[model samples]
Target: MSVRHDWYQSESKVVITVLLKNATEKNYAVKIGPKQIHMTADGYELTLSLLHPIVVERSSHKAFPSKVEITLAKETGERWQSLEQKPILVAPTIQTKNWDRLLNEEEKAEEKDAKGEEALNQLFKKIYSSSSPEVQKAMNKSFSESGGTVLSTNWSEVSKEKVTVKPPEGTEFREWEK
Candidate 1:
């Protein structure tokens, strides 16, 4: 048994017309250089010289059907370049439903935190409002014993006894809590 492979070489020429944004139409004598060519969009005239040794001719014609004609020069001679096609790999798409569910859970968590903070503020206000002068003094004493400071609005007022707390050595402490 014998295996046989068939391949064909093909060449093509195309005439492209580019209209400038400034209302001027310029004809480019473009020779398809290599597998790709770069062109500017503005009205400025350009010469495709990157793939040099390949000659290109430019002319103005009134009777011609196309504005620009690009033809491979005879010096290039019927050289056939192989075209390779590679399979493109695409990433797996994420489901819209899963994304929406995750966003909804995050929004709910934020709402719960906001509600908890509001409740804490209300409880602090209630505790401060219901306490009287003697109760406030006792509470301030206890707070000082726990290594915290209590400030009073009245500058003329004085506390009879001062309380201080000293933590035992080798005890781990959080400075932020103070």
Candidate 2:
């Protein structure tokens, strides 16, 4: 039997919604890895080779009575151009799909909170362990002013040691005559 499926993507996650087609949880089996997904529901066998690497520990799925929703968390912040080698799962029910609403507001808020906490913890460790007391104090002040956020900037200087200008030994270097 052929299975029907649907999919949607977000900035940091991909949501794969499989059409249950009246299948129950007990009738389905799923295998998920860092770069692939295999699912057998009812009489259909579906496979997906992910377009990019994902955090297996952070990805999850829920088999509801009418559908199975899989949430994949990307390891990097890059947006995915596609989910699999082929186009998304073919399903006649895509017209009924709610593509915009993946996670509810509360769920999104919780994710933001967890990510913020982790970033702050990492920043704290770096500040306390690597910085002098004065530098640490400055970082704390910056964080306070920025509401505990860090904006990355392209702030860098060319290495003087790597820059060199040498005239060719054989070729006479002459200035252009005006």
By TM-score, the best candidate is: 2
Which ten-residue region of model 1 has the weakest summed lDDT?
A: 1-10
What lDDT score belongs to each candidate, Candidate 1 first?
0.43, 0.71
- Shift in Å, residue 77, candidate 1: 12
Q: Which residue pairs clash in candidate 2?
A: none
The best candidate in terms of lDDT: 2
lDDT assessment of candidate 2: 0.71
What's the CA error at residue 54 for candidate 1, in Å? 24
Off by over 4 Å in 2: 86-178
* lDDT by residue for model 2 (33-111), tens: 9999888875788889988988999999888778888899988988787788665667765456454575576689899
Assess candidate 2 and give its TM-score to the true structure.
Answer: 0.45
Residue 44 of model 2: what lDDT?
A: 82
TM-scores for the candidates:
0.29, 0.45
How would you encode candidate 1's per-residue C-alpha lDDT over 1-178 as one tens digit per residue?
1111122322332223333332124332333554333333233443332222333442121213332323333224444443222335787996557878888999999999999989986875677578776656666665655465443322224245554454567764456655
